[model samples]
Target: MSRRLRLLVTTVGLAALAWLLLASIERAIALAERFEGLPQGVRWLVGGVLLLLVSLGAAVTVWWLRPRRPRAPVTAPDRTSLEARIAQLRHDDAGVEELRSELTELDRRRASARTYLAVFGEISTGKSSLIAAMVPGAAPASDARGGTTREVTHYETSAWGDGWTIADVPGSAEAGGEARERLARAEALRAHAVVYVCAGDLTRSQAEELRWLGDFGKPLVLAVNKADQWTDIERDQILQHVREQADGIPDAVLAISAGGEERFTRRLADGSTEDVTRRRPAQWQPLRDALRRLLAAGPSALEAQRENAVLASLHERTGERERAYRADEAERIVSRYARRAIVGAMAAVAPGSDLVIQGALAASMVRALASLHDVRVTDVEVDNLLRQVRMTLRTGTSVVLAVAGNALKAFPGLGTLGGGVLHAFAYALIFDSFGRALAATLAERQALDQADAGERMRELLNEVDASRLRRLADLTGEALRLRHEPSD
Candidate 1:
């Protein structure tokens, strides 16, 4: 709004508020005068009752409007149930041995009785310096440039307690450091406690990483490193802002200077300038105190949550592997069905008789794909799906035929293969479209989502892409060649 409009609204609002205040005062005075004539005991009792009612009402209102803490996004699945899922996935695809290894490591870590602490944050956020300060016995190299820590390094430190190891993980948000970020995150998950080091207020990515770590329900501390860079007042302000951004995610938010070498130019007696570097003393006592308090319960007491985090990570990794395996299997299944459709079309009695003849073949392909994805389907649903495919093919037969003709022209040699090659190619397109659509829908919805499948089928039917046409042409030629083979 314009300044004039804002001023007018403000003036009217203030005037209305003043009038309301005066009216309230006038009502209170009138009520007091009436109470003056009443018995003193009765008036006192009435006033007490009114005050109690008002207090109760205010308390209820405040309770209703209270702010609620946000729940974490990560959920730890039951260990037994998660193991069952990984076992079943391993049974289906033998490539998930790494997931099995993760479980094995989980058991090994639990048996070792070690408390792991991972320091995580963005690049050049003093994570290495913080680790160096936390563990006086070990020295982790720190640089002004970001991404100095390329690998996860564990330091055995007796400062906190025996069997307490701290991990110096690679900084996140570095240029082309996604793999290292993943490494950092995985290491963080393996730890019983995490110290998220930051030089200032939490960046958006830092906040998100903090939330992810917090969701695991681990002991997490948001440590603002390099506190010496700001004044005391400024440091407090930044800490408060970081706390607000972090909210209930971190157990505690503390500011500590992870002292590192400071570089400056020095002038000798001859007034010649020389570069000088000196190590600054670390002031990370607050962080040490916080971690001590967080880990006071010992490693064994925190093993359950640590296992849950590892299992949750494994579940996610195994799920990714399962999806990848299904995708590859779905491709093979679709190709096999498409080739069979081409052969069936070539063996048909009439030019377009394969449409009616291949109904059972199409239904079989759908069932196979659905079974691969663990989606059970009734025969009625299968038939209905095939019926929808038939209706879509009926409407787009001309487009399919046109695409086949174009493919024949594109590959002149295929045109001389046989008289029914066009029909064979069209059937290849139809079944290819149907199988791909069903596979995608099954993978996405894990159900017989007929509408979504039909829509995808329609789109694929009209997709006369060069690669697809070439593949179908090749399949049609192969089918014709196999049809003329001698019966041994």
Candidate 2:
């Protein structure tokens, strides 16, 4: 009801109470005057009975209408507090459960996606250029401002077979930036192998890149670009430079020319395939060979590309959901808190907690139980649990209240039984106790969720191979875990 309407009703009720009190007083005064004028014998009995009834009725009315105070609102967690909580959750048992769930899911998706052969190298090394040409097609042309290909492109060719996904990320600088982000995504995707590309003469920039990322290192497939343009002297010099770049790699360097040599082939309007082999422009054959070796080691490359495409899409959506769940954790806890408070306040006013209180308690209990499970929690998830609690509590309250009303009507206890104050007190005790207990229980559950969330994150991180992910999976696995896990 509107505040104005509520205020008006309260005033009316107060006025009625005052009028009834005044009437009783007036009746007593008149009776006293009558008894004073008549004999005193009959007056005592009538006066005593009237006073007792009025007193009892007044007490009952007060118990029914007295208001309970409102509860304080729950605030968003503090930044430092939230951070600490996130840290703490990482170390707990609940976190381990969460990690197990994420790891299992990631393992399934990675195998399904067949994300093998990640290309890692410095900018303009023709890493993108090479993958683009070999796959279904090239990435969409872009201005490439500041040499940043921030977009991690995926190329799929169903003709290759089932379950093939090829991931192409921005080139890595030893400094991270776009390449590092790409690598993180790659790790999540679970790429089976890595193809590291280095272009031209291989500057010191190439040597330091791998060492800088230390742990993010991957099995290297060193690809050298612009081999076609080099003279014999230049080739020797380049080969020497490439050796330094390959210093840390397990395999040898693979060279390719981004530009064709003296020979060139072009499609004519004749719609016929013709071979006019000029001196092979920088041959991508070396790069191609290395890629094939990677495939030979595992599943079909073509199928991997195709599967990667679909899995990439699913990974994204699921990741988004997980992040949201993490953020919503606090809200879920607060909701249960509010409901419990409501019930407690109601119980305080009513003697016994209403049907709403019981339903709320039950719902909170069930939700707390579920949050403890291995299943990932999200805001939508917890909200659904609380919603059921509310609905059940509301229904229960109505039923119980109705039954109580019927019993009261049938017995008419207030009219002739022991004082109503005793009944009011009893009802109030039940209601208040239920609300308090529910709140206490909900508080405990919230603590558990808050504590467990981080451990789960750590578990996920541990399950993924940092090197494998940095090279092949990119941020796919990270995305999946963040998406599935709820924010609290």
Candidate 3:
């Protein structure tokens, strides 16, 4: 019912109810007055009966006028259905399995409570020295030769009661370095932040390597080691060069001398040992402070990285699966339309009837292919595609049989049947070729704009083999004969 009509009906019914209620009260008062001359007990019983009837009437009216709640709408199981589809795709696709493994490992890393900071640099870049300076007693042997650290070394410590790990990975410039580089990159991928150490100004190759590291989307700190060897002016120049090479991605660039000069203990003439201090390099306090600031940003930074990585993976995998499903559906649609076109061609009674039936069939197939990709084309677009296919077929070798079929129509009796059969076969071949070409375009996610439609359609039609057309025509002929044959 309309809102105005319902309101009018409700108002009228309420007014009538109010009038009835008033009349009942008036009647009860009149009856009580009449009973005024009766016994007191009789008057009391009459009053009680009238009160019960009024209460029952009010209850009925309120129950009938109460508001009703609307029912909830049913929703599809999107998440469950998607999960099932993903599982099936994974079972059948190797790429999906690889992506799934990567996502699973990423999830595990995100769940870890401890933070990792990886130290990355080329060989002899003071990586070990910088780590030793920050860690005090946990110093590993520092060698000038390359490949000093062949495996990842973890140094665990507590700062402000929170546990943190520093990973010293192998240098990327070592002999047989491809494996080491892969391992170093994998370690860096799992780190919350990276501290890149360098001895002096960066070379062109080293600068490119730093840029590659920045692509991982983690916080970075650039630490220039062995600053004691460079003069103040040279140090400033080196720092500026390093900053330019870091591309504004590093949170901080710090200059520190991780390798202090050698100190010796000498025996004095009185047989006591004396300590001698030589040229002592500065401590790595600046690098430590920079790292502490990055850590202070807390777990939200790592969580954001995880969210981005997972979202990217989900989008890529979902698109791949959706395209695969659409491709399969497009093939099914083409096969269905091809069969229908064949049947329609076989039923043509006259030479010219084949054109009308085949034209309609081909247009339907084009629209069906577009629907598979969720694309909408105008009537003009469909007509253009059909015209292109028809023109191609008329100019190609397929034209000879079609022309001969039309020529046969001049004869009577058996010649009409033969001409109709020839026309139907030729039309079926054209429709089948057009459908396959359209399906290929949709599968490749190509747009059906006029600019490339003719060229793309011709290229696809040329790829259709003559043998396949002949085989399809013969099969259609046999199927039509079987369907029309009389049964015993």
* TM-score to native of every candidate shown: 0.82, 0.34, 0.47
Question: Which residues of candidate 1, in runs, are more than 4 Å off?
Answer: 1-65, 70-73, 88-95, 139-150, 348-353
Give candidate 2's TM-score: 0.34
For candidate 1, what is the lDDT?
Answer: 0.82
Tens-digit lDDT track for model 1 on 1-488? 89999999999999999999999999999998999989989999998999999999999999977885666546767778767877766464554665666677677777878888889889998888777777876854332122334587777767656887788888899999998888888878888989998888888988898878877777898999889989999998999999889977898999999998999999899989999999988998898888889989999998878877877787788789889888888888988988988888776554334566887888889889989999899999988887777777767778878877877988888877655787888888888888888889999999999999999988998887998888888877787778879989
Candidate 3, which segments miss by more than 4 Å at Cα?
A: 1-90, 101-103, 118-161, 166-190, 196-217, 224-232, 255-284, 300-302, 313-384, 395-447, 459-488
| Lowest lDDT 10-residue stretch of candidate 1 | 140-149
Residue pairs of candidate 1 with colliding backbone atoms = none
Q: Rank the models by lDDT, top first.
A: 1, 3, 2
- Please give, for residues 222-322, the per-residue lDDT of candidate 2 as tens digits: 66777766687787788777775545443457567655324456777997666676533346776667656655545543444323432442344334444
As a whole number from 0 to 100, the lDDT of residue 358 in candidate 1 is: 83
* Rank ordering of all candidates by TM-score, starting from the highest: 1, 3, 2
Q: Looking at candidate 1, what is the lDDT of residue 206?
A: 86
Better of 2 and 3 by TM-score: 3
lDDT of 2 at 88: 38
